[model samples]
Target: MRGGEAATLEAVLQSVEDPEIPVVSVVELGIVRGLDAGQVTITPTYTGCPATAVIEANIREALDQAGFEDIQIKTVLSPAWSTDDITDAGRQKLKAYGIAPPPKGAKAASLCNKSVAECPHCGSINTREISRFGSTPCKALWQCNSCHEPFDRFKCH
Candidate 1:
């Protein structure tokens, strides 16, 4: 691809929104791993997530519509995706969407330790997990004691 084509492709790919979370794009969610001359690499957030196929399909359709039909979408499973890969802007967006973003660093260990998650609505640390699973497989249901509001929290992985 020419330099201009590559730049355009990058921009287009960056703008592709996540199907499950419209507020965040695939790039912001850290799914778009790399962009090359005619290839776009991605790593799904969850292994068995139903949204994985949707994400790939959306990217494919976007690329095709952008006149980059020759570009290939590759899924990279190695270096498995972690919540830490989510960009700062993505975390902010998630919070603004009323979903608590995962804490940075030691994701697996922190979750195992039952780290307190701040309430997305009231910013209270006094929250409890209502369910291990939330509306999505990647999130957990939580309720804020202060505001008595229920929210979904992106699970640390």
Candidate 2:
């Protein structure tokens, strides 16, 4: 693609929101890994998550509507995806939506130790996991000790 065409494709893709998490865009979720002449490479947040297909369909629809129907959407799972891949803007969006963002570098430590999830409402670290699963498989249900507010925390990958 020409420079201008590539930039337009990116802008269109960035405008596509995550089907499951409407508050954040697919770009902010780190789903759009690369763009080429007529292809978009993406890595879904989770392999088995039900939203993966919806996300791709949304992107496809958006691209088609934007008059870039020729652009192909490709899924690449080799490297996998980490919560750490989420952009800072995405993290803020999640917090604003009452979902706790995973801590920096928590992805590596999550396997060995429990990472304290900060309360998005009260900014308290004293939170307890209510369940390993939240509204979605990619999150955990947690309650803040300080505010007693239950919220969803993005799971560490």
Candidate 3:
């Protein structure tokens, strides 16, 4: 991806943070699809996600800063991204940041919007969706009945 091996490029990519969720890096969020010589592939949380462009810009800047200006950034939409793409570390970060992580197999259950989101604050399952949209388009506003605290949960994509 850079002058030689892909691991160096990976390290650089791993440092690129997600703008919407600053607590986790793009890699942790599974935005990075693959790395290889001459190119770095990525997939956004969703195709029309507003942060997609910003994410590419941020990655470009990071690559440039890490001397990977020659490596091209490629975005792919096919086989589209899913909430399952989120890494375990990313899930933990979301919880620590006071956001509920999407439940496993959330994608198929998305249409119902009935997947129970564990309350990050009180670890309770009693939560209700307050809004379909959250601070960011990729997330939904949810309120934990146990803690009475509102939190963002990545929509089951």
Highest TM-score against the true fold, candidate: 2
Model 3 per-residue lDDT tens digits across residues 54-132? 9999999999998877889998987788888899999999889988887767777654466688888888999899999
Query: lDDT value for candidate 2?
Result: 0.87
**Full ranking by lDDT:** 1, 2, 3
Arranged by TM-score, best first: 2, 1, 3
| TM-score for each of the candidates | 0.93, 0.94, 0.91
Top candidate by lDDT: 1
Clashing residue pairs, backbone N/CA/C < 3 A, model 3: none
Instruction: Provide the overall lDDT of each model, using Cα atoms, as 2-decimal numbers.
Output: 0.89, 0.87, 0.85
Task: Give the lDDT of residue 5 in candidate 1.
Answer: 86
Give the per-residue lDDT digits (tens) of candidate 2, residues 1-157. 7888888888888888888889999999988888975799988887788899999999999899989888898999967788888999999999999999887676677542257888999899999999888888788899999999999999888
Better of 1 and 3 by TM-score: 1
Residue pairs in candidate 2 whose N, alpha carbon or C atoms collide under 3 angstroms: none
Tell me the lDDT of candidate 1: 0.89
Which stretch of 10 consecutive residues in model 3 shows the poorest summed lDDT? Answer: 1-10
Which residues of candidate 3, in runs, are more than 4 Å off?
1-4, 110-112
